[model samples]
Target: MGIVSNRQNASDYDDDMKRAKAAGIDAFALNIGTDAYTDTQLAYAYQSAADNDMKVFISFDFNWWSASQGSEVGAKVAKYANLPAQLMVDGKVFVSSFTGDGVDISAIRSAAGCNVFFAPNFHPGQGDFGDVEAALNWVAWSNDGNNKAPTLAKQLSVSSGDNTYKAALDGKPYIAPVSPWFSTHFGSEVSYSKNWVFPSDLLWYNRWREILQESPRFVEIITWNDYGESHYVGPLSSPHTDDGASKWVMDMPHNGWLDMAKPFIAAYKAGSKFPIEFLDEEKLVYWYRPTPKDVDCDATDTTMQGNPNNSSGNFFRGRPDGADTMADEVFLVTMLKEPATVEVQSGDISVTLEASPGVWSHSVPMGVGAQSFKVTRGGKTVDSLSGTSLRDITDTCPCGIYNFNAYVGTLPAEAAIDQLQPDGLTMLSQGLQVACPTNTLGASSASAT
Candidate 1:
């Protein structure tokens, strides 16, 4: 998971670690820039990880550092190499990066004065770094063959990037990335200019299945709290939204996505195929953009062209490349203990599908108004989400700004009965009743539909 450096205290890191641990996450890759609070935040994060029995490693943001700063990067890594929470591999420090392809890895290891397992993202041809022990492929989304300048008109093969990276690794470890969605609305207002959306209908469900099939050495979810890009799978922590991203992220909650990922994560670690066996509770997780794609806004941010820093901007204006590629539909995934009938209602459009016992994904065209969902087994309503529970899809842009961000919701919305404790952590109320009946389904019988 990618953790931004905007935390206030150790407690903030503790809360995130606890939640991540509960989700079966092992470590957090702290993405830090050259901000003044980098050291302070890293200290808090390392301490919290140690307290929570979680591992952590630093991932330098090359946007702030240049190829000449290899020594500075190595010094930072060495400073925390001996920390209790630092992630170590084979008695060597585990180091990674977002983008620092041309940097000298030998200089980094020489400065650190220790063995280093380097796994930096060297996209657009994994550079000639013979010292790289492993490689990290950061292209998590489906796109054209071009990684630097993707053609919006071409549809690339699914998991094509992973295949290429595996071939390039030549039997070495390849860290594959998996992300549910991607859409940013930043412009020249911020130091960078980025605005675009990949075609991500059912991406969250599809990518997990792909991971189970490929079983890469390591799988890093693209982000945990990248609100500006709208792919955050963590809870909405207001304190971490200081990057002017709250405008679109405040009311949007993506905890349901994590809940849906629990079973898949467990199965992946267990070396199992497409998981169908851990359906202890029935869950119906759904996600969709609040506004229709056809809606017009006063400003349209330009689509990103490879590097955000080098791209020109028009303040808050320009149309995204794949805007027209997005389907006007509500994507959903269901985890059931038995065969059931699922129904999705988006405004006046309702679509029903019969799902067998296991995990299933389906989508229905979106409509204007409140959305609702339900699961029925043997002609009885087992689980459901009323229309009043979620925000209604509208024709106008939210707050007059284009928000391609997705709002995810579950059948038994956990937020409805979540209680904030004295320690500033939210927990589900104990012994809460759920609409879906529980069952003891064996993992061997679990299958994906």
Candidate 2:
């Protein structure tokens, strides 16, 4: 996210920082254009970013700033020789939040030892800006950035726009910045959609997903703050915490965007395609399971929140990496049944699941891949499933990383699964896991055909 105009001063930035770190936020300094302080202030914000662990962007919000700042914006950012070249936490790097008319960004990239990312100020979620000019400007910005190469282009083959971003496609280097947001009760958020998060009225999830599909490079999630905008996906809240289930909504380093960002960044880094569920105007991603239980278990033990052995395990409830979500009255396929004779290939046998109504999970040790499973029970027969291809999954939510992700296709349904998508993949941290409904999801309701 950008600067909180009121919090330009380091001390004042506390609230903003608190919010940013909340829902899984990564910080990008946008002080360049604020014109909020003097040369000393800029220097201070620079140090403040370092102290706060935020990467300073040459936002130089100069387009409309006072003329005096206009001249110094570029030079000032250039002057900060020691500022972070990339986001200290996620490695996105110091960049220009403000596009249009700037210094030779290539020179800046070389100086920073990284290619700069471009963050355009445009989101219908916040409020439509009336014109596509900003979008057009971003496109222009990409072409402009592309004309001149930056330093790290050699080391990293990142692009400003992979596809959705027209500018980058024209040959720019900045990743198409897609600001993913979330809303949680405790100022904690991942999407603008309300899950006790920031509220919105758009299918924001699908909105951003389209954006991600448009770009193959970076996609910056908007604000990392539970900033009061009802658009906050960060744990930063309104000086209040809602006690329903999640406590992080009120705390940080304990709960906030920082924690949420890990899974997001990882998902993107892994190139996992996000599986989204509609939440009002905002299309939000799932952070916590409807119930806190093992994805494979149908049981719930709310009293044993602290019990690791309990099916309601403290599994991250997180989506990135390997996380298992507890489903109510549902069971992940724990024991696979062989319907036919087993055919072992080489040394192991592959088993295909019959998850038309259930999800299956796999339990395997690390360093085990390109390997198959064994199925032998009372002369039970096992059919072979394919482990040949890995799906090129995209982030359900966009973050600035060329991530890889995937999910298995579920049985065809008559309609979109209730509350959940039929094709959604439940992440499992412990064993290889998949989720299936004991009953058909949204069997009666079709997709409004």
User: Number of the top candidate by lDDT?
Assistant: 1
For each candidate in turn, the TM-score is: 0.86, 0.36
Candidate 2 per-residue lDDT, tens place, 19-126, comes to 454433455445344443445555555566666665445554545554334234444544664465234323443444444343343444455443334344432233
After best superposition, candidate 2 residue 223: deviation in angstroms? 2.9
- Report backbone clashes per prediction: 7, 70
Report lDDT (Cα) of residue 263, candidate 1.
Answer: 85
- How far out, in Å, is residue 176 in model 1? 0.4
The positional error of residue 222 in candidate 2, measured at the CA in angstroms, is: 2.4
Worst 10 residues of 2 by lDDT: 277-286
Model 2 lDDT, full chain set: 0.31
CA lDDT, every model vs. true structure = 0.72, 0.31
Write model 1 residue lDDT over 65-181, tens digit each, in one string: 787888888998999999999998878898988889888887888888878888888764646446687888878887765532246467675588888878777887889888888
lDDT of 2 at 403: 11
